[model samples]
Target: MSFGDIRVAERADWLIERVATAGTLVLRKLGETRAGEKSVHRFLSSPYVSVERIVETLAARTALQCTGRRILAIQDTSEINFAGRDKKRRGFGPAGDGKTPGFFIHPVIAIDVESEAVVGLVDAEIWTRAAGRVTSRRSRAIEDKESARWLSGCQAAASVLSDAAEVTMVADRESDIYLLFARKPERLNLIVRAGQDRSLADEGLLSMALAGAQPLRSSVVRVAPRGPGDKGREAIVELRAGTVRLVRPATVRKSEAPEDVELTLVEAREVNTPPGKTPLLWRLLTTHSVTCAAEAENIVQLYRLRWRIEQVFRALKSDGLALDDSQVIDAERMFNLTAIALAGAIRTIQLVDARDGGPRPASDVIDANFTVALERLSKKLEGKTLRQKNPHPLGSLAFVAWIAARLGGWNCYYKPPGPKTMRDGWNRLAATLEGYALATQHENPGIP
Candidate 1:
């Protein structure tokens, strides 16, 4: 809907408040208060209430937070599988099982490189594949393809973060497109995993070039457990760095021909993997120069922060937002709901990330009532021992997080709580605040 419409603005504000307060609950539950069920439905069904507008608003807020900082625009794609619904459902395509129907979402999230805090979502695109559509990869232009999302994401990030000191476009192997590198903006740099064994300027493949480089450094890195079947472990990894010039692929048309792109490649391989454990191997390509082991390690660390986007996806999925469980059938309505959910997911991560470090004020994220409720909760959650008491300054994000973590059952001895724990804590705290608000309203009937 157009921003000029007062109804659209009112609905947008309501949706944002609902998302921030209630989180991933179904619409009936979210709008159960003042607006009622019909209002919620009308809000979602409104043509002026759009996914792009919602995303743009949130992205602008994110960009404001990123002022004067070196931000990492971490981009990645995840499928929203709505498989097993009624076969007559209209707006979906082949998903996980190929027979099931769903769509894909590609998002670029800006992160503070120094603090590793999730700044905000820079941009997001949602689309479904055309039914019965198939095109030869070599013949189609990049502009007409889905893979162009990577380049577009980079461009969007560059534009949004123009005032920042620097913007590094970080991605996984899936984003290692030749055109992305050749046409990358001067203001933007890249740190993507190498997916192709391309021909180098010195007549050698990328893999061979990396394999020939001598190890420059060694360090131990923690590897998070991937699944229930595996255990988290630490491994000693060796780093190697090299520079290579990537040649243009023959598949790219003459008119679209791009100059050879020179990139610094760094490989981090585990020196000794435990029995039954897979060794860590990451070959990273970057436009940033790496002359020393410290510089290479910095690049590796930046790439590691790419996991933040994965956390966002997890927040949107079953573990957090439960987006796949959404009952919306129409594509437009679903996209609008997903946009709201996306904003909620980012806020969830922001709270979790703000727990330990950073000087962000709690008021910037949490409402005064929520913060007051958490403040009341802090006294009860803290222990007699000084160390067990809330260590963060009052009115700070860390202070609220500390209380939430305690309410979520963190004993203060284990590692800091992740997003799931914080989510549980926030849900409980929200319920408490709701009850408190009701009691306050009853005590003073005429209060506005």
Candidate 2:
């Protein structure tokens, strides 16, 4: 949290201060003075402000926010590609595209399942593959591959949310690793989309386990778009759930691996195709017990929440921060900037989510000192009638959002404010807080 030194702390604070506003990640643009710009560059290049330190700071916040909540620890990996800039960049390796030069980010974000609001970040692993031909998977162990992050993600959620009432780690297909399920802590639960047609102890394929299972229920699901600009479609899918014992593969190098691991399988298969559109089918495997239709539906609902990370990714790239537009070419500095940009993107999404009037507290996103000031600002925005007043409780995140939407010029008559409006309002609110702090410091000397 100290960032190793007073100067380092100051520099890191400055970066977080402006980045949290959901603005651009450009250093000079974000800086108030020439020295502030240089400070940001130095902070990213400093060995003290490493990725581990920043993640630790985020995890500490997560631990405090996650207490007594049922958590959906959503884990995901995204690639940051710098294809044509390979010549100018240093200390970099191949991206997922293999030909391009870039790196990968695997993040685990915590969400309170009951309130369905983001709690905080549990962990993030940032790394790159060495340049050259990759080794064959058949000859390598799980620890020697990028897939190890899945296991580490589980470990992180366990340690960070030790006091949480319940923890269920959710992931997409890439996390369907046998070792992960076998070695997962007993205290932690798992829900990963099945990618492999793994063998079963019953001498059957995992893909066939639910083929003949009776339909427990049906529901409509939103299908994601095929491309960047296209709107997604909706589909009606039938749900089915069953249990199976997965047999460990012969190629598994872990001698301690169990012969079989029991897990529940939940399937949501599309009922009918609308023509030309892709069908919606999800084969989810989990450690949570499923005995009824309502219980199986809960699993499907939680797995759908994985899309929240995709929204953060969109905000981090094309929609909000545009991290690729940054001019920093050095790989080390880029990595640090990536970490800051990610925090900014996630916070931006949190504020946008708050705009809809959730039950989340104001302190979830703002400092306690700012709440009193926010209350004062809230009063100034109210109109004559009670209908014009903010409907949310005084200390909630929705209260802050109402103030922000008002600052962004929302009439409170149309549909709720969008992300751009929320971002504009949030920045305005942040600038007002800065002005308030400066004004009060002269009188109280150290009040903030």
Candidate 3:
């Protein structure tokens, strides 16, 4: 079916609507009457509507309202663990766990760093291999077909992002090692935290170049905290500056490594911390030239934007969707389940963008359609015990859950017998609240 023809059902939209509070389980429960688990599953699993499209849609809508520089693309990965089994499956990648197995979700997210608004999402696979003792005795076995296919997932993701207006790949030390960034296609510029003692060619000392100059020593530098860094809050280090000219890049001793490229090393102050704190120093390397202090400062500011991905990760893992809640039995099904949850999270973000009233809400914005559907659901359960005792402010599911959890009847730990338990729970709650509403109306009919 064409995207335009897709119907916005009362139940589906209701599920989407509650995603902000009740989360995926509530959405699935809300969907059970109008559509089965399979239907909700299909809606989430289909690739036609992806996080990329959702972000792009928001970007396009925002673009019509404001204008700015070309887009800046940032790429990074996060680890999501799986309960280990003897073997792995397609789309599951290694997660750096030496023992228990896991997968990597490498997302290439683009944003207007200036605006802090995300505009695109591209995910790739990084499959894992069992470490020593988990697999065969042979130490250097080539990957079997199941794991080898992730190479294409990586390349395909890169190919799609190759055309971004301007691309900058950011990562921790893992991505800084020579192979991943240095060997990446030249079109991509990278800003990564470097590993200590990585190959380097420091040009002849600047004092040596200038006659009768005293040798340079450590200088005092002030470190100022900017906003949060990729890891956490960032600080700037300032020192007596000097420049180095590079004639050749540092050579890699290993034959398997990529060829070297030229880099200039300039040293500055020793910025140490209190007795409990460790000293800080930055030995930065980049393909871009640093002609002035302002340029150097901009690079550090840009790297700080890497923290934005952390927020996205939180949104996927804990913010409402709880993508990790899936109970799928195996790797393929687990990955498919993860992808579905990501779509739900992405949709929730879009819905919030559509409804957020500034930084806070001044009044109710739930549409008439959603309000009526909720009322209908409440009416349908009037005869049950869970009548609208004190119908939730605007009758939101979130408010209902809060009430149930406080009223001593709702057990988050309760395991329902089957899929029907969700609908039954809501019906019960509605019946109680509705009855209360009726009693109050009868008692206070003349007051209002």
Give one clash count per candidate, in the order shown.
2, 0, 20
Instruction: Write down the worst ten-residue block by lDDT for model 2.
Output: 439-448
TM-scores, all candidates, are 0.91, 0.94, 0.53
Ranking by TM-score: 2, 1, 3
Clashing residue pairs in candidate 1 are: 1-48, 1-49
lDDT, candidate 2, 3-71, per-residue tens: 878778766756875886747887887776798788888888887988888888888888988888899
Query: What would you estimate as the lDDT of candidate 2?
Result: 0.84
Clash pairs, candidate 2, are none
The alpha-carbon lDDT assigned to residue 152 of candidate 1 equals 95
Off by over 4 Å in 2: 85-87, 222-234, 254-256, 382-388, 442-447
Please estimate how well model 3 matches the true structure, expressed as its whole-model Cα lDDT: 0.43
The lDDT, on a scale of 0 to 1, for candidate 1 is: 0.82
lDDT of 3 at 92: 47
True-vs-predicted CA distance for residue 171, candidate 3, Å: 1.7
Return the top candidate by TM-score: 2
Ranking by lDDT: 2, 1, 3
